[model samples]
Target: DQQVKQNSPSLSVQEGRISILNCDYTNSMFDYFLWYKKYPAEGPTFLISISSIKDKNEDGRFTVFLNKSAKHLSLHIVPSQPGDSAVYFCAAALNTGFQKLVFGTGTRLLVSP
Candidate 1:
C-alpha cells in the first residue's frame, strides 16, 4: 500500500519563527518527493521537491530534507509570516509513466502576528 503520513494535523507559531512539518512513508519504491502549499479554497501549489538520490533541497524560505534509510522527510519554513498560514501536503511518487502522486492528509500551519 502507498501511504504518505503527516503525523501533526496542525501547528501554530509566531511570526518570524521557524515552522517544521514532518512526514513519513511506507512505500519504499517512491523515488520522487514533493511538498505543496495550499490556501483556502485553492489548489495546492508546488513548493519544493527532491529526488531520492538527494538528501536535501532548498529554495529561499523553504527547505526539505529526506532520510531515505528511515523513509522519512520534513519541511522547514524559516521566519514564517502571517500569510504562511495554510495547509501543507507532502507527496511522493515513482518516476514512472503513471506519474500519480500519493499525498499526506495535510498539516495546517498558523502563523500569528
Candidate 2:
C-alpha cells in the first residue's frame, strides 16, 4: 500500500512566486516528515523537515509544515526561482530505533520565468 502520496503529479509557478507542494499519508505511526529535492540526474537531497512534535520547520527559502491531525504535510518555497525547479519527494518515518522512510511518488515542480 502507498502510505505516502503526492496528489498533484506536477505544479507550475512563476519565478519569484511562492510554490506550495502538498503530501498526504495514511499511516499514523509516522513521527518525522522530510522533503527532498532531486535534480534531473542527481539523487534526492534533503530540503527541509518537520518532526511530528512540531507544526513547522523552515530553512531559508524552504519551509515544511506537518499537520498530524490531518496526516498531511506541505512544503512551501518562497520567491521560487527557475533553479529551484526539480522533482520533490515527501518522506515519512516512524520513531522506531531503525529509521525507515516511506516516500511518495514525487511531484515535479516547474518554475518558469
Q: Model 1: residues >4 Å from true position, as ranges? A: none
Write one digit per residue (lDDT tens) for candidate 2, span 1-113.
89999999999999999999999999999999999999998999988888899998989999898889999999999989999999999999999978799999999999999
How much is the lDDT of residue 2 in candidate 2?
Answer: 92
Residue 6 Cα positional deviation in candidate 1, in Å, after optimal superposition: 0.3
* TM-score per candidate: 0.96, 0.98
lDDT of 1 at 36: 95
lDDT of 1 by residue, 20-82 (tens): 999999999999999999999999999999999999999999999999999999999998999
Q: lDDT value for candidate 1?
A: 0.95
Q: lDDT for each of the candidates?
A: 0.95, 0.95
Query: In candidate 2, how many clashes are counted?
Result: 0
Number of backbone-clashing residue pairs for each candidate, in the order shown: 0, 0
